[model samples]
Target chain A: MPEIIRFGDRGILVNFEQKIEAEINEQVIRLSEDLLHQHGDSLLYTIPAYCSLTIQYDPKRTNFKALSGSITSLLNRTTSPATSSHRKIEVPVCYDTTFGLDMVEVCANKGINSATLITEHTKPTYRVYMLGFLPGFVYMGKLSQSLWCTRRRDPRLLVPPQSVAIAGAQTGIYPSEAPGGWNIIGRTPLPLIQPDAEEPFLFKAGDLVNFKAISLQEYHEIEEQVKTGIYNLKVSYGF
Target chain B: MASSHLALYFAKPGLFTTIQDKGRFGFQAFGVPTSGALDQAAADLANQLVGNGLDQPLLEVTLMGPKIQFQGNGMIAITGADLSATLNGDRLAVNQGIEVADGDILQFGRPVSGCRAYLSVRGKWIIPTWLSSRSAITQNGKHLTPASIVQKGTTIRIDTSLVDPLRSSSAAIHPPETDPGIRVLPGPEFDRFSRFSIGEFFSRLYRISPDSNRMGYRLQERLSSFSPEEELISSGIIPGTIQITSSGQPIILLADAQTTGGYYRIANVVSQDLDILAQLKPGDTLRFSLTSFEEFS
Candidate 1:
């Protein structure tokens, strides 16, 4: 049984095993979806992390004892993973020197060329674990051991929006300009967040992402098309 | 138009002024930070004094306050910190509703007690909202990276003609707490640290570091040499979580804190005491007092 602890006065934290395995996150996400569906009226929000799910509820509406009891019952009923729609998204990345700020340093450290870096970086169909640190920033992971690299020694004060960066086993695209310590290897022209849209974020947790390398010319072309709202991202749903 | 009758013409925008309300909820799953007023009580009081709803968007001024000229007549109130506010060369009191005439210039001086002050004008504001919130994500709430800072010469419009008149009398002035110790409950990883480290965390004095901001308050004092036993998987965190870093210093996450973190969460400040911490400025000294969930509620 997962441990359920009180987080502050208004939050309840449901913790799984302290590991980064995909199966644990799957359980966390499943619990989050079930909790939302079952107790949406009482919950203000829920944050699903790698191994835990934190639910913030209204203290005025329901106290901790009642809420935790309901959560425990829900967890007990949950025996199998809930089957839901998942998406396979192919994101286009430009690995040109102009946009990839620390590409050369990363290549030199790994003793590999830019071509090899691109091939290895784009090889995996990464899973979206969780989104945090910034709005719409999707944390995807499980890069090949050969492509794993440490973060930058000196973090950048402001990484440009849509910069695809890697640190340790994790890779993420910055939805907006933010201070980041990750090593930038490529840039994506697609806007990751549109606040006014029906769905603001490009990728939700539990989705699968694949990167496709494109030339700088194609990047600019796609950028312009995106600006005109004519470009369509390669996406397959119901995975 | 009603906009012309109710507006604030800003001649000087003080340090770190932003529009804040109760905050944007149900969006943490999307990695959005809750970028609202740091002090909820003060924000609500300001709105109440101005005859606005409790969740109405109001201006939050940090340290120094703004110099606003009323374009037209409207009821306004200033609460939270007493920044020596003035109206056309006359001293203005906080936590009270006051009427302003056209061309009346309101200015603020040095802070008297607290770090932040809230200002609310009588009416429904005409500000644009992103993701169902009028709160401006200026500093740590940079999820959208919108340059939402209230700059000098900016004008804010309100529909004062539509709202009802103020009915309540002036609110009583509630001063900041004199106590230096913040009450906290043990977190998920409270037992992860050594007994000595845990004792040091509760007993030692910690000053708020200069680098502290809305995201989190970085404490200056470090506990006697200790590091996390193992790397923690990134997990959900709330506003008052106290995460101990590799260097042994503790950081209390605040209003604009990220939804998830990988550091060791030793404790979480109770929700009621969060307002006390919000009024604190940089260089303020504080200690932690362990409390039980039964006592906290």
Candidate 2:
């Protein structure tokens, strides 16, 4: 079940029945699209989380009761499709010692070999569940049970942009320079957030992500291509 | 730098003064926080006094206002804090427009009440607008740093062409008295806490700590009352959301707070009563009462 909760005078939070359900995440994304289709101008922004969607608006222009009632009605009237037809995006990652700062730490904690951990992490398909904390940072989840580990007790004061990290059951990419507590496992050359780009963010909620391991040399080549605006990774979308 | 326009020189710069407007909206998606005046009542009052639009730019002075001298004839008004004000050595009344001739000085005394004050002029301030807002955010010092307190030699421009004589008049408006009851509504994460913790939250009176600011207000809650092991997933947080951290201290998110947080939110302060919270100074006692939107609307 989808629940609508008031955040403040100008915001409403749509939460799912379960905290980490894939169906609920899809519903949130679909609802976000529906809201944008219906009242995009009225909305200040939509924050899609793991199992919830928070829609912020201008209170002077939008009435909370009417919007919440309308959303509830919409959710009740519609049934979410069994599976979301989303795009599959492949991200090239370099798991070298320098880029993967916590690779040794993760291996020691999981009691697994570096090669085995990398193979398992890259093999599974991950879903983008939320975008938060920073611009263009995607929060995707439910890593292989073996790769799950606790986050650092104290977050790094500054984690460089494009750092791929994992903490517990989730994985994410840093879009900008920000403080982070996640264990960095690899680095990607792609720009998750580009303020000057025509499309600022490459990935949205409900997108499928596949990690392709690349050599250090390939990483440098891609980095140079990205800087020169020549690198173009395949990105296809259906729904 | 010399300009063709007139300038107002500062005689004595008081505590803190910054330019403000209605605030920049629709930019949070770019990770830009909306920065504006802390007290809208004071800002609106000053704007109304000067016959400017309710959303026009104004000076937000903290506690005490800046003492300024006019370079040319201009209409201005003082609102917000009851900081006794004088124009050209003559005491001027609050909420009223006054004309200051060239070389005339305006001084502000210590505040009688209220933490913030507003001053407005008939013509808009000639400062550059960033992200469509003239309001300055201290965090964005690199992009738009706030002007320092108006000093004895500092000068500001006045657009005589935009002045409206019809808007010049002084009206008396008193600030509201401090209220003790702070109303609140149950939050989305309210059920996550133990029943005893919720009871303690409602019954206990929390004092506004000295470490309060535009970002948040840290309150001293009884730590032993609640023991939460669940690490809350970071979620969208808004102004007035009372988030209790791992150490069991309650921090109320405010205007310039981050968009998302990973702490448990016990309750949300009702919108209508947020102004009351904003007016509270350090050492003030606040009692939380559970309520809903229906109580205000």
Candidate 3:
């Protein structure tokens, strides 16, 4: 069972076990879908995090007491889980030194060679826990324990867009240039966010991701195709 | 359907000005910030004076107000901050509706008390809507508006065919005076903070740092005692969330704050007091007053 607590006066937070686990995040995502479909009219917005869902509601429409009660009853009466659509997205990444700014540092810190590092990094079928911190910036987790590394003491002022990076127990790609402390291990040529497109985000919560290692030549070719809007990301639905 | 005509021209854009509605809603899950008017009450009052809906898009002028030339005659109301505004060299008062003629230049001088002001013109704003809002935002290299910030020489269009002539004669109401202290409710992580840290948070006078922007306000002083043993995961946060940084500084997230952050949310400013913080300029000093949920309700 999760705890429904007051977040200020206008918001309510449904908090589960505080941790970064797939099962915990799955519940958050499910509840988010339920609220959007069921009680969205009363809600201003809902933010699904790793193990929590913060719901902002209009005080004029609904109050915390009534909304929390509704959420509690909804949680109690859940029949299986809200089966929403999910996707498994395959992203092509190049680990060439030109793009992987911190590859050597990561390899040295983990006491492994570049080849071993790439294999370990690409081995996991990471779950998309949530998208926050940046627009379309997918936060995935449970990287190979061997590759678990701390973020840099001094973060870079700007990490280039589509740079796949790892820090602590999580791995994600920077959708745009931002100040980040994660260790950059590869670069993906695909644009993860399209603000003006019909579907703005490339990845959403509850999606699965797999990283495929590519050569520098392939990276450039795909980059050109992406520039011309000819390349499409390989995606598998209903995972 | 009437075509919108150019209404206001920005001869010299202010320090920082942008279009804001109630907010960009239904997109926080995608990490989109709800960029809107920082001072909701002021924005609402300004719009009400012009007989416009509270959610109508308007300009939020910061620190210094803009030098605007009226391209078309319309009823306008200036509220929130007393920036010593004048129309064609004649002084104009806040919270009052003023009718303007074409080519009338409105200029703002030094800010008297507040950091931001609201400018509401009578009409439907002819602005691009992103995520179902006219609020302008520039995040992660992408802009919601054509230009990131309102630039000089820009023209704003509005449809004024439905303008209510009686709205310009609406009596002005006194805007609420901002309190010196901000009221706040304990956040989810408030219990984790040490007693001394909590005490200092409510007792000490903190000044708004110079680097404050639409995203959040950074305090000049750090809490004397604050060191948490655990790192908080990145979680959902909204405007008015007061997060304590690793360095013991408390940052008050504002209208354009990111949806999620990893810092400990020590407290959240009460919704009623959010307008007070919005009107406070950089270098302004204030203390926090702890208020319970029951008290706020």
Candidate 4:
């Protein structure tokens, strides 16, 4: 049974596990999607994380005891054994020295050359485990163990938008210029988040991402097209 | 047009000042945080005094206050911390609504108590609402990031025509001088820390760190450390979540905090006491007290 804990005055947290695991997050996503589909009206918002789902609601609409009752019932229901997405979209990256702010440090720390880092980083198709920290910022993970190292002791005060970064076992793209401590390896020209658009977020949790490297010249071409709103990134059917 | 009737030009943008409302909701699933006024009560009180709905957009001033020049006439109210506000060189009451004429300059003195202040004028604040909120939020709610803090010489328009000041009796809300114990519920990872860490958490008084801002308050003290675990998952975090970092220091997340986090959340401040947390200034000391979950209702 998922542990039901009080999040605050009007929210309940359903934790599926104590540690991070892909399977656990899959369960969390399923539960969140199921509950939202079943009782979204009663919910003010639902935030799904690696191993937990936090449901926030209005006290007037439904108190903790009442909300917990519904959540408990949903928890009793068995989560289907599977993944949320089979499709993987290709993401183009420019790993030039100018774009990769600390490519040397990451290469040295991980004991790999730039070629090996780029090849290994792009070799495996990563999962969109969750989106957090900022709008359109998707956290994907399980970078090869050899690539695993802690985040910077002192985070940069400013990391530009769409900068591809890795920290420890995870990787993410900055949707916007924000403070972060991740090891920057490359940058993408695509706008990963757009608040005013009909669909503000580009990558949803549970999706898969494939990285493709491009030259700096190609990066400029794509960037120019993006500026003119005339470019579209390649996304094909997956898994 | 009503928007033209109210224009604000800042002679001095003291500290951090920006527009805020109840915040954008229903966007957390997309990693967008609800960025609203840190002191909701103060924001509401200021709006109410000006005859505007409590959720309407208003100005939230942090630490220091802004110096504003009005282009037209309107009713206005200032609430929250006693910033010693003035209108056209005359002292303005903290919670009372007053009328202003064109060319009037609204200014503030140093803060007397509390950490934030709210200013509300009659009519809607005319600005683009990104994702249904105007709270210029992001980056720990510190006025440091350019996300929403108003810069000097910027003129902001508001839909306006002065309403007679609400004239209804407005209560002066001076915060209590007594140090408040922030009420909290045990976090999901409450027991994950050593028992000594938990005990130390309750017994110790932590001063707010200088780096603190709207994102979360970084506490000055360290506690018995929690061991590092590999593969910690990134997960949902909310305002009032007291997360302990690897450095053993605790950070109390507030409005504009990251949508999700990976640190161990040791406790959560109750909803009622969030306003108290919002009013905290750097160097101020605080301690936590556990409360029953039932108290949430």
TM-score of each: 0.96, 0.78, 0.94, 0.92
Whose lDDT is higher: candidate 1's or candidate 4's?
A: 1
- Tens-digit lDDT track of model 3 for B116-210: 89999988787767778888765652344554357889888888876554444455544435437898888989889988889889889888999
Q: Please, what are the lDDT tens digits per residue for candidate 2 over residues B190-273?
A: 998888888888888888788887667888655467778777666777668898888889888776666667788888887666
Clashing pairs in 1: none
Once fitted onto the true fold, the runs of candidate 2 whose alpha carbons sit more than 4 angstroms away are A9-11, A40-45, A56-64, A78-101, A112-125, A175-177, A186-203, A207-234, B1-20, B24-35, B57-78, B81-113, B119-179, B191-195
Better of 1 and 3 by DockQ: 1
The best-first sequence of candidates by TM-score reads: 1, 3, 4, 2
Model 2 lDDT, full chain set: 0.75
Candidate 1 iRMSD, 1 decimal: 1.9
Candidate topping DockQ: 1
Residue B112 CA error for candidate 4 (Å)? 0.9
lDDT for A204 in candidate 3 is 89
CA lDDT, candidate 1, residue A203: 85
TM-score of chain A of each: 0.95, 0.93, 0.96, 0.93
- Residues A1-239, model 3: lDDT tens digits: 89988887799889899999988898898888888898888899999999999999988877877888888987898477655567989899999999999999999988899999889988988899998887778899889999999999999999999999999999999998888999999999898877678887888888998999999999999999988999988988765
Q: Order of all candidates by DockQ, from best down to worst?
A: 1, 3, 4, 2
Considering chain A alone, report the TM-score of candidate 3 relative to the true chain A. 0.96
Q: List candidate 3 stretches off by more than 4 Å.
A: A78-85, B1-4, B164-179
Q: In model 1, which runs have C-alpha deviations exceeding 4 angstroms?
A: B1-4, B139-148
Candidate 1, TM-score of its B chain: 0.94
True contacts kept of each: 0.77, 0.29, 0.63, 0.73
Among all windows of 10 consecutive residues in model 4 chain B, the one with the lowest summed lDDT is: B139-148
